[model samples]
Structure formats: C-alpha cells, structure tokens
Target: MNAPTVPVLQVHQLTKSVQLEDEVLHILESVELTINPSESVAIVGPSGSGKSTLLSLLAGLDQPSSGSIELMGKPFHDLSEDGRAAARAGTVGFVFQNFQLLPALTALENVMLPLELQGARDAEAKARHFMDEVGLGHRLNHQPGRLSGGEQQRVAIARAFATQPALLFADEPTGNLDSANSQKVEDLLFKLNAEFGTTLVLVTHDRELAKRCQRTLVLDNGTLVEAAHASTGA
Candidate 1:
C-alpha cells in the first residue's frame, strides 16, 4: 500500500480582527481550510471581505489574531516573525498585483534576486531559464520602468517560480493588467504552475480566473465557504 500524502497547507479556526475606537472590527472569523499539494485553488469575494488578509495569514507574512496555521507541515502560526521569514525563505513564493520588482534592477536581476538570497550559485542560469519560459528573455536587460505592464507581470511570474517553491500565493495577479494581458498572464501562470507541480492559492475578483482553478472558495462577511462559482463583484 502507498503512504498517504500530507496536505501542503492546513488552517483551523483562523481569525483576524482589529481594534477601532471603542470597537473591535472583525476581519476574519473561524476560517477553516485544507489544501493538498499540487492543487490550484482560488479565493474570491466582495470588497472588504478580507481575502487579502487571509492570504497574508496563510503565507505567514502576518500573524493571525486567533487559530493556528500549518504550512508545509510546520507550525507556521507559532513562529516568530523572523522564524516565519526563515520558513518561507526557499519553500514559499509570492506574486502580487502590483509587480513588486525593484525599479532599478533589470528583469533578469529581479528574477535572480531570490535565488541569490537562497545562496544558489547558479542563480543567473536559473533566472534566465525561467525568464525564457515566460517569454521575457529578450527583455532581461530592460528594467521594470522600461517594460509594459504585461511584461512586468511576466517578470514577476518568472521571479516567483524561479525559486521552485512548494507553494505559491498570488494576490490579484491580473488586477493591474488589461484584458488581453490578463489572459496572457493567466495562461503563463497556470502553465508554469503545472510544470513546476507547485500548489497555487490565489485571491482574485475575476470570475473566469477563479473558475480556472481546481477549487473555488468564497469569503464573505469574514467567513469562508466552498463555492461552485466565484462572484465577480467589487
């Protein structure tokens, strides 16, 4: 008999809230989820539904107010800030809506940054390979300011996957792109995801984008539920 595979991410009663003037605003409440390795999942909802907040907690970028998060079988929620950073060093990757490329760096340098940080001696070679995979090899010498929105996003994608992380988190990846560019980025994102066997968890308001994932989740009023179709509002 084969051994059962462990889930890539697990959450239990996750919650987040903030203190306002004489009030406590709840952002998330008792969110429960499990994601297996190599699965593609989307989280969508209305504005102020706390989608991005949940993503941050799951990625261990921020601490939750309550509940535990297990990422890649480690107690992510229990770690200190620096410990969490250590955990994500090579195992987790992220692609954000605003291409977070260093403006001064060339496309290839942006892609190579993470690899170099991880002490990979062949950072440039790996960066070049993924840059070519995203059809951005020709623009490697160009800086982010010199590239179009689509090209910048493609560069971000290359940077994310260059680390070959076990999991990836994308926050409204196509939010800043036009329709045509959105479609192109979506294609490249899924293509690289499949090739790398990386588990994907994304937050998008685009219904079509959500539908492309194997599973869709809805976040509403600080709660989460499985969804057959994602709502395209806000």
Candidate 2:
C-alpha cells in the first residue's frame, strides 16, 4: 500500500476573543479546515472579517482563545511559545504587503537573513541563487531605500523562498504594487509554488489572485465557509 499523506496545515474549532472592557470581540469562531501538501489556498473577506486573524493563528504567530492547529504534522496551538517558534522556524515562510525588508540591509543581506539565522554555512550562495531566481541578481547590493516597491517586494519574495519552507503565508503579497508590478509578483508567486511544491496560504482581497488558487476560504464576520464551486454548485 502507498504511504498516507499528512496535511500541511490543519485547524479545528479555532477561535480568537479579545476583551474591550465590558464587551468581548470574537475575531474568529469555530473555524475548521485542512490544507494538503503542495496546495495553494486563498482566504478572502472584507475588512474586519477575521481573514488576517485566521492567518495569524494558522501561522502560530497569534494565540487563539480556543481550538487546535497542526502545522507540518506538529501541534501548533498546543505548543509552548518557544516550541511554536521552533516549529515556525523549521517550516514556515512569509511575505507581507509592505515587503518588510530591513532598511539597513541590502537585498542580498535581506535574502540571507533567514538562512544565516538557521546557521547555514551556504547562506550567501543560497540567497544569491534565490535573488537571481527572482530576477534581482543585478540589484543584490541595493538597499531598500534605493529600490522601487516592486524590487523590494521581489527581495521579500526571494527571502521568503530561501528557506524553502513547507508552507508560505502571504498577507496581501501584491497589495502595495501597481497593476503591472502586481501581475509580475503574482506570476512569480505561482511559478515558485509550482516549482517548489510549497503550500501557499494567502490572505488577499484581490478576486483575481484568489481565483488563481486551487481553493478559496471565505471568512464572513468570524465564520468560515468554503467558496462555492463554479460548475458543481449554484
């Protein structure tokens, strides 16, 4: 018999609550889902609909009030803070709308940070390879202030992929780009995923971007629902 596969990410009864003096805000509620390895998924919703909150929880960056999560077959919600950090270090990558590059670091240094942190001896070589992959080899020594928004985001994408994580969490990866740059970044994102078999979980308001994913999860006022199929459902 063939070996069974494990989900790249899994969640059950996930929820987040916050106190606001006399009232409680439920940021997420009873959310449950699973993502297979190498799958690309999008989480879409209006502002304050808990899309980002869900992403944070799924990535184990934020704690949920009640529920469970498993990332890469390891317990997420149940892990201690230090343990969760270790888990993330091993199997997660992230890209943000703001690009989140360190102003003091050059594109090459920015791409090398993660590998260096992991004590890889070949960080520079690996970073250079990814930077070249993202078409930034010519700009490797440029600092964030010297690069355009698109270039900065490309640097960010290069950094995110240097670790080759099992899953990539992208929060509005193209939110800050112009239409042309956005399309370029989008094309690169898909190409990287298909090439690396990295499971992608993106939180985006862009319908076109979401449509490119293999699956879409819609969040509405803290509830989770899978988007309807185009041809199989009305």
Displacement of residue 28 (Cα, Å) in model 1 is: 0.7
- Measured on C-alpha atoms, candidate 2 has an lDDT of 0.91
Go through the candidates in order and give each one's C-alpha lDDT. 0.93, 0.91
Candidate 1 overall lDDT versus native? 0.93
Pairs of residues clashing in candidate 1: none
**Candidate 1 per-residue C-alpha lDDT over 91-177 given as tens digits, one digit per residue, 9 for 90 to 100:** 899999999999999999999999999999999999999999999889989999999999999999999999999999999999999
TM-score of each: 0.97, 0.96
- lDDT per residue (tens digit) for residues 1-234 in model 2: 978899998899998999999999999989999999988898999998988889989988889999999987778897888988999994899999999999999999999999999999999999999999999999999999999999999999999999999999999999999999998899899889988989999999998898888888999989999996441110
Q: Could you tally the backbone clashes for each prediction?
A: 0, 0
Reference-based TM-score, model 1? 0.97
Measured with C-alpha atoms, the lDDT of residue 44 in candidate 2 is 95
Shift of residue 230 alpha carbon in model 2, Å: 5.7
